[model samples]
Target: MAETTGGVIDAAERDLIIRSQAGDRAAFGKLVEQHMKRAYFAALGFLGSHDDALDISQEAFARAFDSRAKLDPGRPFYPWVYQIMRRLVFNISRDRKARGAKLEAATGWIVDDLSARALREGPAARLERSELEERLHGAIAGLADQEKEVLVLKEFEDLKYREIAELLEIPIGTVMSRLYSARKSLAKRLEGVV
Candidate 1:
């Protein structure tokens, strides 16, 4: 694997990129298969709508394919695809806000299998965890879009500070700052609950 500005690019993925750039649908499908879930979740983190995320993620891939000739096989693929998806997520989010539509809280995004754990910890513990997750999701949803974006990318997507910076095209310090602000806001929101 070779490290590029985007990230690590394995040989197979690089070949897929090359073939994809040559207008090979199967190669492009392979690329999409690698990234589609992450793309949808990334959009969901921003828009908080499953339907919107699905649509925007797919649309991003379509647009990416349309501009396939511009793809650089040397770099990792997801970052480039993420750039496309991010724009669509933001545009739709802004439009919804402008029209006074409430962005749904991504309450369902976090999933923990509590059935077995519940047997061990009891129903009360499960209920508490479920409630905590709800509160956390609500607090996260209430964050400013920038703060939310940084938080989701870091905490949920599990991207490193450098990776988040590269993905968002921002400085690492900015990413850290936004994450700090997000944490503080979440703390304030969950002060009593937690």
Candidate 2:
């Protein structure tokens, strides 16, 4: 079966993983270029801050380069890299939680960029949509790490259950369970927001 990824990079991932495993820096750069946006957004979905997301994602790439020997030449590269990323984000989240909540989340991070033009068409509709979005953001941010990860992969990253399971190294049933729990949490959090 063909590998699926966020973009055209899937076809090149195996060759790039092989080359990078042999210490080809240029090959790794191509891999980075291909996957950076996906990595950044993945981190953003976890960390919920643009600066933290960018930093953590870039650091994950650097660390992946350092540990390139462990990368399997026959496997898709992204899932391996995502392990590093998820760990980093989890650590950072733990640290932040220990330090207590601050002003980390803001409206700028979860914006729907296209909402502006839509807003011009209907003021009441815009207000309702904005409120719902705010509530949704709050709900997502409050989710436990595993639940949040599953939800983001399914809803934002648009990964299939099998793909999420493969990437996270969990069973497909576990992916469905996590997704179901995450959705239930979001629904409870959203409550009656309209």
Clashing pairs in 2: none
- What are the runs in model 1 whose C-alpha is more than 4 Å off? 1-8, 113-130
The predictions' CA RMSDs to the true structure, in order, are 2.7, 3.1
Q: Estimate each model's TM-score.
A: 0.84, 0.87
Off by over 4 Å in 2: 1-12, 113-118
lDDT of each: 0.83, 0.82
Native-vs-model 1 lDDT? 0.83
Model 1 lDDT at residue 68? 89
Best by TM-score: 2
Q: For model 2, what is the error of residue 79's alpha carbon versus the real structure, in angstroms, after optimal superposition? A: 0.5
Task: Give the clash count for model 1.
Answer: 0
- Residues 73-144, candidate 1, lDDT per residue (tens digit)? 878888898888877877886787788776564566656565347557978887777777788777876788
